[model samples]
Target: MSHGSSPSHLRGLAEVAAASVLWGTGGLAVQLIREHEAMSPVTISAWRMAIAAVVLLVALLAVRRAGELVELARSRPRQLLVVGAGTAAYQGFYFVSVTQVGVAVSTVVSLGLAPVLLTVAEAVRDRRPPAAGRLVVLVAALAGLLMVSVAGHASSTGPAPVAGVLLAIASGTTYALTTAAGGSISKESSPLVLTSGMTLVGAVVLLPCTALVDGPHVTTDAAALAWLAYLGVLTMALAYVLLYSGLRVVAPSTAVTASLVEPVTAAVVAAVVLGESLGPVAVVGILLVLGAVAGLGRPAAAAGPVLPDPDPVRPPTAP
Candidate 1:
């Protein structure tokens, strides 16, 4: 409040922006290895959370937290459990949905609709409404999502597979909660503490599901394993840290819009890794999504964060 925003705050915002871009690639990576491995979503998710957790735990011990793991461990076990259980459910549903549909479909549905969903979630919890900028961002993002839906439909058009579409929508709904709930956890705690505890919870819940449903045999392929590791280490574990740290300075809508990077990265990766074809229309759709996200980032007054209404039946959460 003194001489504009501090340099440190500005720097932190940038870091969060960068983290979001990296996160945007997650779906594409999932698509690449989805069929390559026979493991269930639970297995993939378990490995991801487990590997990321280990890396994060070590990082916190050696550098960030500096030997505070035990202290954190003792302090917030229940909250950790709650976060992990929520994460497990979220990932399991995500895996099933992505498997049922396609990567693009799932991501567009979940993320596009996330703003509106999260707005309501926050409103209910805080008993207050969203800011105008946040609402605008939601509308613009939803419009972009609608474009994505049309593109997906045009790609197929054989009755459109209603179930998969529905699943994709459900994925988006979970994402809304994922973000709102996830972000709320660390206001009074360290990001590493929050991430580690929540992820541990996820692993505990998912490990069993992986065992019961996915069974003993897991993917042995080194490439699949490597990708899963990357998801855990870079996307889930490290990414969250960067994103959270950045959010301390960056506005939430701006941070999320910057995350459009994940999809762009994922799309390019999908093209190269899975050999999945894309047409001009898909490219245009990607451009539109990126453009919209970019537009939302101008400035608070220029075209900042777009939010949503407080009412429960505000609108359909997907495009």
Candidate 2:
């Protein structure tokens, strides 16, 4: 890694961490929405994506960036669409995992698996093994993620843990692909443009599934609407913009590792808001996860972007 890229790498890590923190609050919001409105996971995801896309589009038009969206659509339509599909798959699988195994395990399985998958994929593509120190940090981060998540699993009796785990694995795979692809896509377009184009694609893919799963279920309650707005604006819109911006310079493995902060934030929120216990183990796990993230984001860990540049309209064909 070149020293010239160090600042960019650190910036990327910070952006990703900020996004993760926002995402940490998402589970609670989703739960609130479910309580207020009887909607399936798919339906909630649909609403989240669709509303977010609309919000981004409106903001773009308001700021005179609609032309950027149009240009990106024309220039990189296929890659953006692929990224959108991956985003939809990630959310769909994650929410389903949440319904089946509870939020803790779902979050653990999905987020935990992403860095490892990215590490392996990168190694394979680069034909070089990860550095010893980086590998150690990665393992430590994964362990801490598992510890925190398991400790947070106070309500393990949700549905089917096994099925949820599988779904969460799928979610992780999709998430990894999305993040890696985002890195490549960022090279071709700005984060705002990418977010606008990709979210539209995700909304298109998820709308039909939402309709089939929830069957015209709609709610206009103030609380439900509030939760939906939060999900759309914060979780979907802001978070994704941060994610893509980070990917512009962050290695996929480092980005994913830093994002383990999500579970830590989620745990603390659960303790304070949901009145769940953090326990000594969970607290220790939080420290470990944070430490690993810090290590991964340090100047020493700086590396070039994990993927090569290519046509934005191409299939997101490689890492």
Predicted model with the maximum lDDT: 2
Q: Candidate 1: where are CA atoms >4 Å away?
A: 1-17, 31-36, 64-67, 73-78, 101-105, 120-136, 148-170, 214-216, 250-257, 272-278, 296-319
For all predicted structures, in order, the TM-scores are 0.74, 0.90
- Please report how far candidate 1 places residue 297 from its true position, in Å: 3.6
Candidate 1 lDDT tens digits, 1-319: 1323345445555565567666656666555567577665567778788887788777777776643445545665555565667667755665566656665566666666655555565556667675565566556556555555445444432234466667667766655555555544444456776677667667677676765774434677788877888889888898777765555444444555555555655555667766766566657766765665654443442122222212322221211
**Candidate 2: lDDT of 170?**
97
TM-score of 2: 0.90
**What does candidate 2's lDDT look like per residue over 1-319, in tens digits?**
4423356667778898999999889888878988888777688788888899999999898998787777777776777888999999998898888878887788778998899898888778889887776787888888889889888786575669899989999999999888888877787777777898888999999988865674346788899889988998998899989988888767777888888998899899989999988898899899899888888655454222333333434322233
